[model samples]
Target: MSHTVVIKDIRNVTHDVKRIRLEKPSGYSFTPGQATEVAVDRDGWRDEKRPFTFTSLESDSVLEFIIKIYPDHDGVTEQIGQLTEGDSLIIGDPWGTIEYKEEGVFLAGGAGVTPFIAILRDLHNKGEIGNNQLIFSNKTEEDIILKNEFESILGSQFINVITREEPAGDHVFLDGEIGKDFLKSQINDFGQAFYVCGPDAFNESIMDALKELGADPEALVFEE
Candidate 1:
């Protein structure tokens, strides 16, 4: 099913990342870590639809999405980045299987942390966030999305890795290049389910590393 959501606010989280707040329609329900297909009516790109994860908590009446816009990508993200308040867009019902478990480590790279934001927020509200750890990686400090928000919620349990600007922290090569030693240090149990999201190569590499670290194949979930 499709619904019309009006943009209520827009703010930049980073140079290329924007947070959009939308007016939730009546009778709409969504879980943390879920995503929806969005389409904005614009010339030459009215048919462009893309999946974006919700960043708002489940109890919130409004809907929010964190989007990273690459002017080079010819899709809804670019169009969405150009939108202003009061603009209306069509969005598919919430979908996705990446829901939060009772406890596990969240490994996200770049914008992949969008879905986890909602998950972490819900957990924080319920006092369940203390059991989970988040390891986020980006090319530079400026690339870290929702940095302050994550820190405020997860506190010292969150680990931020900046690969370019400094090497003082937990920096790794690319996602695929994340070593098993580093994975072991961050994740206490290989038996725990691993929730990973990122670009294609990033997801693949992390899943592969999880397997190498003795994680069960069936226990891994990556964004589709």
Candidate 2:
């Protein structure tokens, strides 16, 4: 079954992303890193369902989603970008396989970082962040979402890789794609769990690289 929820608040997260808070239905709940099928509750749009990760913890009063919008797509996300406060959305039951399993490294690309948002927040809130690290890759600095929050939560453990342009302000820049060499240089133990999320190609490449670097296949968590 699906429920219609009203937009309580909505604001920009990055240049092409929106942080939308919605009214939480009584008894509604979801685990960190889980996602639900969501569609705009409007004529001609109610059936355009898409999956989006919850960026808010289960204990939060409202449901939150950090969505990346592509204006040129002329698709669901573009419609989502045009949405305003008080707009409604229809959401289905929560489902995802990217839940946190253990303290380890998280690799995210672009808007794929949404799932890790709540997972990391929950960990930080419970003082269980431990030595968890995050390696986030974006096309440019403006593409990185919640930069300050990640820095505060993970400190130096939060690694940023800018692929398209040189980021100002001393942010770490990667010359090429994340490969075996980079993984070997940054990670000391390949036995720890590695959480990865991104486009299909990115996910495939990272998982392959991790496997080649001696990371256990079972320890690689992602939305498979």
List of clashing residue pairs for candidate 2? none
Deviation from native of the Cα of residue 131 in model 2, angstroms? 0.8
- Backbone collision tally, model 1: 0
Specify the highest-TM-score model's number: 2
The 0-to-1 C-alpha lDDT of every candidate, in the order given, reads: 0.83, 0.92
So what's the TM-score on candidate 2?
0.98
Clashing residue pairs in candidate 1 are none
Task: Write candidate 1's Cα lDDT for 1-224 as tens digits.
Answer: 88878999999999999999999988888898899988896667656788888988767888999999987876678788889999988888889758876588888889988888998888888887766888898888778898888889988788887655655544444443455778887777899878899888889988888999899988887787
Question: Per-residue lDDT of 48-69 in model 2, one digit per residue for the tens?
Answer: 9999999999999999999999
- In model 1, the runs with Cα more than 4 Å from the true position are 167-177
What TM-score fits each model? 0.92, 0.98
**lDDT score, candidate 1, position 130:** 63
